[model samples]
Target: MRIDKLHTIDSTNSYLKRISKEEDAQEDIVVWALEQTAGRGQMGTTWSAESGKNLTFSVFRKVKRITISEQFYALMAASLAVKDVLSKLLIKNVRVKWPNDILTDNDKICGILIESVIKRGKLDAMILGVGLNVNQTEWKDTPRATSIKSRTGIHFELEEILSMLLKQFHHYVDLLLKGQFETIKNDYEQHLFKKDKPATFIASDGTQFVGIIKGVSETGKLILLQEDEVVNEYDLKEIQLLY
Candidate 1:
């Protein structure tokens, strides 16, 4: 339950991992920054956040019994945690965009990046990085972005949001520890964006296709049903959901 608050940082995940290499970093320790000069996102994208206007932090959790193959479940738990808190906050149409982004009403409000440390051919620990827009009013030219303040018309206390977010994290983590994989996956799919609906996608080869999101595999690949009854499973970067 210890949080290391920094006024500014290059990246919370990098800081925690660097310190873990230097010292024995405690499990459940959170590295949060009021501002990040270089925040990270999924697919190696740079996360942009206004100073003191969003939740930019990373949480360290030591893996116990979770197998290496089910590692994506850890990410699923974390994404659901963010969705749960946003749902309780009255954020309408909150959805867990596949792989890791949090979207509401087709606008992304949060992004996550989970980095794991492997040791002895097994998963050791994971650093869950989260960036959520809180009070930022404008996103420059990022039209797909939105914030809590923009959506709710109310400013929020970042620490309070962090506390509630952690609570949800623990709640979902407990379920994960108890081996409720199907339950977690089902809950995640229930909040999935565009689940079972016709959607357009961009493939890595610069090809566009239409498909239905059939849900995700146990290993976290996107299950897509395309034309002529073709079922395709895609890992990250294989396909991108287009608005």
Candidate 2:
């Protein structure tokens, strides 16, 4: 794995996406920074991290073999990688929220964003950006977020955590590239947060409803069990989960 260390960047994802176009860019490379001025999160929101306090990085994964339709498995691979790492640290009650937000004790500890490049109807490389709240002692703007140090009272070395995560990432993504769908999906849901539980949600049109989560479609749609024997599938941004 190649590491491109930077003192600061606008966004690691953006940086990698730009650099991946270069003829010299290597696969399995990591772009890490001490701080991100324009770190991106899901839903077009900005991720804010204090300089030199947490892990803000993006990994480059060269996807192969699987059709464009099977892209969601790549997402599962990225999510499970982080979940497996946190669990090994003895983090209590670790759960992967739908898509891939990692939660410990029901508070968000990490977020994942996967950006892919496709050409001529074939999939290419993917930039997997991971933002983890590591040693930060406090989270002011995002009160619902927590850190490893905040939870366990012990600080961590970021490089060591990154190495361990990459090993697991290689394992799951290898299965994905081989088109092993069931194995990845089963493990992902088993560690999924709020699986089979009734929860509240808000629709994009400002409609509020209640439903039970029935895992996700192979395409990454959230399957909700509604009233009167109704089942509906929603893509990202169509629905928002309410805590």
Candidate 3:
């Protein structure tokens, strides 16, 4: 694992993508920064890393001989990596929100963005961007955001956090490569949000319904058991999770 550390960048994920075209960077190339001015999240949401108070980094990994259905494995691996790191920091009640959000005590602590570029009927590469709130004690004017420092009143070195994350990420990637999908899937489900509780889901058609989150499908589609008679599976944009 080779890391390219930067003082500041607009977005580590975009930076890696730009350089990936010019140079053939190998798998496990990490790009990290102390600040991200234009950080991005899932569904084109803006991720704001408050200068030196958070962890903003991206990892590029090359994929071969795997179908797109297996891409969720990579996402699960990355989310688990963040979870492992936070667990080591003794962050209590850390859990993964389906698809890719890390939560602690039901508040969001980290966000993950996984982008895949497919060329020639195979996966060319994947950019995994992770943003975690570490030392930010207070979030100014944000709805439902919390940091490790806010929760624990302890500050952590950004470099030390990144190292721990990368170590766990590499280990999980190795597990994926070895075809340990069942193990990863089980662990992911164990940490999933609203695992056995009824929650509201808003569909693309603007209909709201209460359902139990069964788990995600192999292709990363969210599965919901609705009304004890209807089973619905949804893609990313098709459904939104609600309280």
Candidate 4:
């Protein structure tokens, strides 16, 4: 694993993507920025963090043997890694809010954005961008946002947390590489927020409805058990889970 610390960057994910194409980038290349001028979350959402007060970074991983059909494992691996780290830190109720948000006690503490490089209809590599709230306690507009310090009431060293998270990443991604599909999938679902409980959802058409998150589809779509015993799959752009 190679880590490059940047005092400042526009976006660590963007920077790593450019460098991976321009040069020969290896797996586990991490670019951590102290400040991201323009960080992003899933689906073009802006990720705002107080400068130097959180964890904002991206890690590059080279894909092998994992086909496009199995790419959802990447998300599972990364999300599980974050949950693992938070659990180690004694964060209560650590759960993965599907697709990529990490939550504790129904409050968001981290967000992940994954970008992949595909060639010839096969998975090649991916950049996992993570924004984790750390010591920052002040939040404006985003009421559900929380941090490690806020939950634990104890300050943490950013580097120590980063190291622990990266180690978990290595372990989980290795499991994915080793073709432990069922194991990873089961672990991810077990940590899913509201796995069986009824929840409210808003469709892209602005229609609000109720559904139960059963699990995730193989292609990463959300599986919802809806009205009249109906089972449906919705992509990221199709539906939003109302927290």
Cα lDDT for residue 144, candidate 3: 77
> Model 4, which residues run further than 4 Å from truth?
none
The lDDT per prediction is 0.92, 0.87, 0.87, 0.91
Give the clash total for candidate 1: 0
Report the lDDT of model 2 for residue 103: 94
lDDT of 4 by residue, 1-243 (tens): 889999889999999999998886765799999999999888888899998889999999898678888988888999999998998899999999988999998899999998988877878898999999999999899989999999999899889999999999989888988999889888888888989999999999999999999998778898999999999999999999897
Greater TM-score among 1 and 2 belongs to 1
- For model 2, how does the per-residue alpha-carbon lDDT over 1-243 read when each residue is reduced to its tens digit? 789989999999999988888754545789999999999998898898888888999988777576688888888888988988888887889888888699997799999998877867788777899999889877677878888888888889988888888899888877886778999988888888888989999999999999898888989999999999799999988998888
| Model 1 stretches with alpha carbons more than 4 Å out | none
Q: Per-residue lDDT for 17-70 in model 3, tens only?
A: 988877876656889998888999999999986898898999888877456879
Give the best candidate by TM-score: 1
What TM-score do all the candidates reach, one by one? 0.98, 0.96, 0.96, 0.97
For candidate 1, write residues 112-154 as lDDT tens digits: 9999878788988888999999999898867799999999999
For candidate 2, give the lDDT of residue 214: 85
- Please list the residue runs of candidate 2 whose C-alpha ends up more than 4 Å from where it truly belongs after superposition: 24-26
Global local distance difference test of model 3 = 0.87
